[model samples]
Target: MNSVMITGCSSGFGLETARFFFEKGWHVIATMRKPDNSLFPTSDRLSILELDVTDQNSIDRAVREAGPIDVLINNAGIGYMSPFENTSDEIVHKLFDTNTFGTFNMVRAVVPQMRGRKAGTIINLSSSTTLKPLTFMSTYTASKAAVTAYTECLALELAPLGIRTVLIIPGLSPSTSFGKNAGDKISKSGEPADEYKALMEKVQSEFQREMLVQELTKPEDVVNAIWQAVTDSNCPVCLPAGPDAVALSQ
Candidate 1:
């Protein structure tokens, strides 16, 4: 069976994708910051690893133990939703470290082996927030946009070596860990400045109302997109993984 390594498999898209691939009889390495046996069913085809993308030691260790991988999915990332003015430099750096540089670090770890074999697939997870801007999501959008851009350039750089790079952009998924993480980040970043309070409240109200009608992306949308990108040699370099993202992509 072809082996696949995925980051952030503890929840959301990453977890769902891992399960999807496992169901297809692929050897799956589902990694998270903290490995939990209960997260996946017992099988020789499935293995769990601990990985913190921001830490080079962790990334290197996981990749080494994962052995030869046919595909590497950089699905590990953090989200922040706060007014730019209120977003601390520490938070900004944290976002980039995990969202942008984290992807870079993982690619660095896997590419040499892939290039040697002249085969592999790299699937990166990005947010639709990069396609359509939002009021309090500047930092989050910027971080994801960097990944989207990086993946596009990588598609060009790796194609000649027979390695495929795909970008998966999905829309707001309130039911996923992304939403819970965003809220957690907001708490860490603290409240916005008083001057922006009224505007922030209005934006939040509008967003809640919009959510009632919006066709939000589900984890399955991204899971299917990754499957196609891995199985279809002629798949597009960039794929929008949900209704909202598809509309934004156009």
Candidate 2:
């Protein structure tokens, strides 16, 4: 039986992906910062584990407990939004800690085992914003952009080792908790600068308008793309998950 370990299985893409793989009969190691087995269906193939990607010890322990795995999904991440000048050092560090360094830690933990086995797949979740930068999202875009670039290089390096590295870039998904979580962070960061306040308002209005008219992608589409990344041996290093992403890629 093939086993897959996924991070951030508490909600959104991670939760849906966990359910998808579990239903498909793969041993699903669903991991989150806090493990709750009730969120997933009762299946012998599903095991929930607590993992904090920012903590190397936590990542190391989770990888050890997960045992041999056929796939690793680095899906745990946090998003932040604010004018670059308004973004604090603390917020900047926090964003990179979760979105960039966290991914690096997870990859470092699993690579040894995957390398030894000479067979495995690593799928990373990145944002479509990396294709076209958005105002007030420079920091978040940079973080995910780093993941995209890292996966590209890693794909070439790992291919010879029989390990596949795939990136799933999903477009804006308001259906997920990502928007709410990012909003919560922005709220905690206080208000925007007076100079940028008007610009921010205009950007937000335009963004909302575009969202209403645009064919936004769903979380399921992302999960499906991820499934393809896992099972398709010939899958490209970068798999854009939604119509918006596909459009941007072109």
What local distance difference test score does each model get? Answer: 0.90, 0.88
Best of the candidates, lDDT: 1
Lowest summed lDDT over 10 consecutive residues: which window, candidate 1?
A: 178-187
Model 1 lDDT tens row, 1-250: 7999999898888999999999999999999887988989999999899998989999999999999999999998887678998888888888898899999999999999999999999999999998889999999899999999999999999999989999999888866766454443334767667989999899999988878889988888888889999999999999999889999999
Per-residue accuracy of model 2 over 132-171 as CA lDDT, tens digit each: 8999899889999999999999999999998999999999
Q: What TM-score, to 2 decimals, does candidate 1 have?
A: 0.96
After superposition, candidate 1 runs with Cα above 4 Å error? 182-187
Candidate 1 whole-model C-alpha lDDT, 0 to 1:
0.90
TM-score of 2: 0.95
